[model samples]
Target: MHQALLVPEVLLEIFAYLSIISYTQTTSTQKLLAALARTCKIFHEPAMYLLWTEIHGLEPLLGCVTRLHPLIYHSGTWWDDSDEPWTKGVEPLSAHEAHQFLRHSSRIRTLNIKSEHPHLLSVIPAEACVFPRLKSLSLSTTYLNLFLPHMLHRCHLLSVDEGLQSFVTRCIALEHLCIYTPHDVHGTANELISDRIHWCTRVVTLSCPILD
Candidate 1:
């Protein structure tokens, strides 16, 4: 190992650059970071941190579990080359497997969940404060009931359904909320506007596409 690699700042800068480069070369960057993580003990923490700090979906975190099987390509759904493969499992997750999942889950600050997989939520261990440091979350209404327990600072909702008020009320720490509804110009839900007014006083920002 080089002396420069021994410096915390230097290692962070290197990993940070790789994180940025991941924007255009995601797979390559991930492979490089994974290699760095396995290179040595000192490189492990920062390398893993850079790899897991921000994620687009739940697949990466769930991938840590050995028992869960990926169901994306086999489900008849088109698997996008750019995204992580979706997974589903019915086997019981062992304590060690759950620990591995949580180890990476704790590092995530931003999460964007697209499709709903009830099995995804089912695999999580009970009474666990998953994503303890999570700050921003983007998820659809199908995921609405799953992440309400987190102390999120920002939330973006897509494909919103009924019960908007009840959902917003539970996010006590939410500072910003963006709701995207499928309703058109003349079909905006009255309950949505009322709920926004009700929550506007507490939350710093309440954004809705229809209102704009």
Candidate 2:
């Protein structure tokens, strides 16, 4: 009985210190935490904050919503093509969920919206967004050309589409922009990433396709 009471407390402290990414590496851990969280309100707070803050998995996220109430954290969820458990059924980015996320925009200081999901553009609002602490905005989307001119300053890793030599018009407070292009899709000009952009002449790294 003594160990049982102490176990959850121990887990809570340990979980609070661990990085958000580690929580999703093992599906079993996620399920375990979810189970513990459901046991009482105490477990729920950490489970939701620690887990939802850094979301990298879908199944666990889906499970989270089912167990917990609607979340308001702007978890830096980076769902690129490299991610796994790619169940087509999830469609990870949905309009319904987007609203849930946006509603809590204040809670989300840093958001990572990858370019892998072309449809995600529709789910997110363009201008007039208010994220007080939002210092980093990472966008890896198919609609880079459309949103870049507007939201680049909101993020550090500004992922773009195509390696086009466009003039760095306005990317104040920008840092670490990544342009992604797959091997098979060479010359296809998918995404371009320009980094280290801030109000001043911050170091910027621009990635584009080399025309050989």
lDDT of 1 by residue, 1-212 (tens): 78999887789898888757767874678788899999999999888877787787665665666655344334534444355634433544566766766767767778888755555466564434577777888887665655554477888887666645544566678788887765663445745665554764558888876664
Candidate 1 residue spans exceeding 4 A from truth? 1-4, 7-9, 19-27, 69-100, 123-128, 148-151, 161-170, 184-189, 200-202
Tens-place lDDT digits, model 2, residues 1-212:
34654565666676665446456576555555566578776566666544445333223233334222222122545334465523333344466665443443443444565424444335555433434434455555443343344234433333334322321554444554444445455333432322211222543654434312
Native-referenced Cα lDDT, model 1:
0.68
Clashes of each: 0, 17
- Candidate 2 displacement at residue 73 in angstroms: 22
**Top model by lDDT, which number?**
1
Instruction: Report lDDT per candidate.
Output: 0.68, 0.43
